[model samples]
Target: MTLTKPQDLSTEAIATLIGKNARVYTTGDMLTQDFVPNRVNIELSDTREIVRVWLG
Candidate 1:
């Protein structure tokens, strides 16, 4: 996925795109512990827009 900063991709779209490259994908609030080690964790804004992407 050739993602650029501030891209207007939705959380679901980000998940699908990352899922294609990663073995697993997860989405949740920043305060939550919904993360899998060695997996991709996607953080989205309140409007469901991609805010951050990282490996847990």
Candidate 2:
């Protein structure tokens, strides 16, 4: 949930760290409105690079 230099981390790395609780996608990807308290959302760039990370 808490990562240092998260931008330096890859989506797969995050998935490995967070397990099944993570949702990795790009900025223009469609996402559901329903929020899961324990889920982690990872947003990526157009180039498929990680841009942001948050808890939902």
Model 1: what TM-score? 0.40
Residue-level lDDT of model 1, residues 4-56, one tens digit each, is 55456544665677663332222553354655575665566655455666776
Per-model TM against the reference = 0.40, 0.66
How big is the positional error of residue 35 in model 1, measured in Å on the Cα after superposition?
Answer: 6.8
Runs of candidate 2 exceeding 4 Å displacement: 1-13
lDDT of 2 at 41: 91
For model 2, which pairs clash? none
Off by over 4 Å in 1: 1-35
Clash total of candidate 1: 1
Best by TM-score: 2
RMSD of 2: 5.5
Q: How big is the positional error of residue 11 in model 1, measured in Å on the Cα after superposition?
A: 8.6
Task: Give the per-residue lDDT of model 2 (tens digit) for 1-56.
Answer: 76554355465777788785788888999999999978889888876667888898
